[model samples]
Target: MPETNPQSRTGLAFGGDYNPEQWPEAVWSEDVRLMREAGVTMVSVGIFSWALLEPAPGVYEFGWLDRVLDLLHENGIRVDLGTPTVAPPAWFYREHPEALPVTADGTRHAFGSRGAICHSNTHYRAAAASITTRLATRYADHPALALWHVHNEYGVPVSACYCESCAAHFRRWLADAHGTVEALNEAWGTAFWGQHYTGFDQVDPPRATPTVGNPAQALDYRRFADATMRENFVAERDILHRLAPGVPVTTNFMTALSQCDSVDYWAWGREVDLVTNDHYLMTDGRRTHVNLAMAADLTRSVAGGAPWLLLEHSTSGVNWQPRNPAKAPGQMARNSLSHVARGSEGALFFQWRQSRRGAEKFHSSMLPHAGTDSRVWREVVELGSTIGALAPVAGTRTVADVAVLWDWHSWWAQNLQWRPSEDHDARERADTFYEALYDRHLTVDFAHPEGDLSAYPLVVVPALYLMTEAAADNLRRYVESGGTLLVSYFSGIVDEHDAVHEGP
Candidate 1:
């Protein structure tokens, strides 16, 4: 595995996403000045700059980016360079409109929004690879480069595509996983609805149907979508690893259960050089702090207890919520430090400066629209100083008293069309169980269903609708070895194929 820690001059990483392209060249100097005042150490650049970097297909524009890198390096701030593959240029979309993702109901997403991509599209993959290569080759030795942020956030806004291309891709994935169509039919229990396929070409993504579709097919599609995204990440990562050898490569993960449940972090955790997460407070009436702690703990656990980065959080409130509420006076510092206490290498926000115009203009930032004299600015500076003082805590691990089992596969299965009950929410169950542990002041570490559990004296399975034979046997061994196990209702009822287990 590659080094999990980011390359930073300061022991702890700081700062947030910086989009100098959004402002004029004159404002760049002022931005750096305030960044220094706030003790900003590093900022992620070029996350959504694909359109600006390559205005036209095969036409590269590196002049502005070169200047930005030089300016940041001169100001003593490191850079988490992004590949800018999240938002392809409008021209590229016009050329290959088929690259746009299609929803299950057959609606193709427009390119105006971010993450409107079909991971199975060849044109999109080639274009993404080309830009990633260009970035790695251009700034491989840049003095300010600290880390490589592959994409903005995968499995956000959109996760799967149900287009013809995706159908073919899913068929190939199924062929690789099951070897033959006969094996797939047995695994999917296709005999029930006469859905059995005699050949791989007959399979397709679970699209809109008159009646409920096969749960097993839906579960497999989820796995295939996740793997497809991971494949793309690995492609970009390999380019960076080859061109920019020492620098780490990562894509910010939305590990919060409420934010994104598409991608499997357990699988993604192994692909990244460093595990990082983007977490926002949900104001849906539950305890926000508990959710924050749970997200942080789960992210840390994904990294196998290694120190990870708080890639993106809010300085105050967010814009996309039902009612965006500003953080209380000291809430920013408290929210940041709480992540650090759970095992984050540092804390960074969604953006260094808030947007003046755009969908996220109202989103909170380190430097708010109120300018440097505002409370957000003051809190940003204070938090920087506090983080600098806690540099000694870097590289340390957070030990947990209990382990909570979480599986994206199981979550996907439980979320299928028809289940034991529509009221049974897997995420809510996990949250409730974790909240109980939180109330007891027991630090929790999330574990995979089949992962090693001997280290944990107490292991709790909040909800796991789909369990593999290996995972079931592993739990039995854990109890046999004297470890206490607590399982909630509606667990271990189905296998990996979503088929009900016999002799239950």
Candidate 2:
């Protein structure tokens, strides 16, 4: 197969988020100097610099960013130009109060934290689009610009909103999807609890209720949330493509679902130029390598076996983990190469340098807070050189005799409200199966049950309770074709709407 590597054309993308804007102009030189010592090739710039990029509404400031990008370019470092639209300015909320995302409990979120805006918020989408325009117009032709990292991790915390606007949109989405109230009621199995809806207007969001809210409604809400976030992503991608036509656009995905099925990476993969992921070590040292390998394989599968990027991982312990245990010596480097082995052309971390302030102050970085003297720094330097030696592995494809089928929608709907077992742990179930194959020295590729399964000798799916009609038909055809199939306890037990299948 021809090389599918687009993002890292020059070399392996070995750098992470470079926030020179956080430091003074004086530190830009030092950061770039260290970038060389660490063998950095490409770095994502200004992921959360909205406040700096646009200090006020309708205002643009590129003076400091120009210097930062120039400094990195001078040092032979490529740039993943970030649009800085993740966190809108403080003035955004002040100017448009409706931009604030409302919590499930009916509380409007404040702007201090990242991802406080609802995906369905019109005001926020407009604001994000405006900033993306400004950034693209300014840096479209910059020599250092490589890719566009649109809005930091989507649906991180405030993925859902119970606000009236979102509720109305959700209802309309339901109407468009199911076509009619009768079809929706039947698909949702609303007859179970006298919950048949007469019209779309009668439907409200699956917000907090005095009792267990409808499972089917919640499932639809999850779909709506994913669609909403994807709309925002496409909006940004269109703007970037309009201005900087050739530049590939991407947004990082977490290893696990942070929100309730908010971002369907399998679906999102079709839209982005390349697939990328952010994986933080489990900190408990609990099969971190296996977990990382699974994440890389899944990401590669989403990229259609094309080379993907490790957008963010950790150099050492992350501050968010409870105990925050550091990785053993050489463990961190091994963790990185493991991804490269599984078809990741680029391996990067969260931040280039450890933060001196803010929420992630204790989070590890390429340059530790203790300067270049710490073990993290030494390991970072070593890993950078090691990755440089891995050019032969670049552009190579990863294949396996085994496949693990993952369905994000099924995972979300499996354990909602009530089920046969409260211990319906999909992630853990998938982990157990992966560990068994991993221990036997067998490589595996991840796939959606609905996706093509002709590449593997064995196909295994665990906790796939909610299988769609097309996926069911695909499985039937695969089995008829004589492919070996392995399934765990709760496979193929329900339709897409969390409604159980009738008698076997």
- Leading candidate by TM-score: 1
Stretches of candidate 1 exceeding 4 Å from the true structure = 1-9
How much is the lDDT of residue 74 in candidate 1? Answer: 84
Worst 10 residues of 2 by lDDT: 1-10
Q: List the RMSD of every prediction in angstroms.
A: 2.5, 2.9
Candidate 1 lDDT score at position 147:
93
Residue 256 of model 2, lDDT score = 47
- How many backbone clashes does every candidate have? 0, 0
- TM-score, every prediction: 0.98, 0.96
Give lDDT tens digits, candidate 1, residues 139-178. 9988889999998789998889999999999989999999
Give Cα-based local distance difference scores for all models.
0.92, 0.84
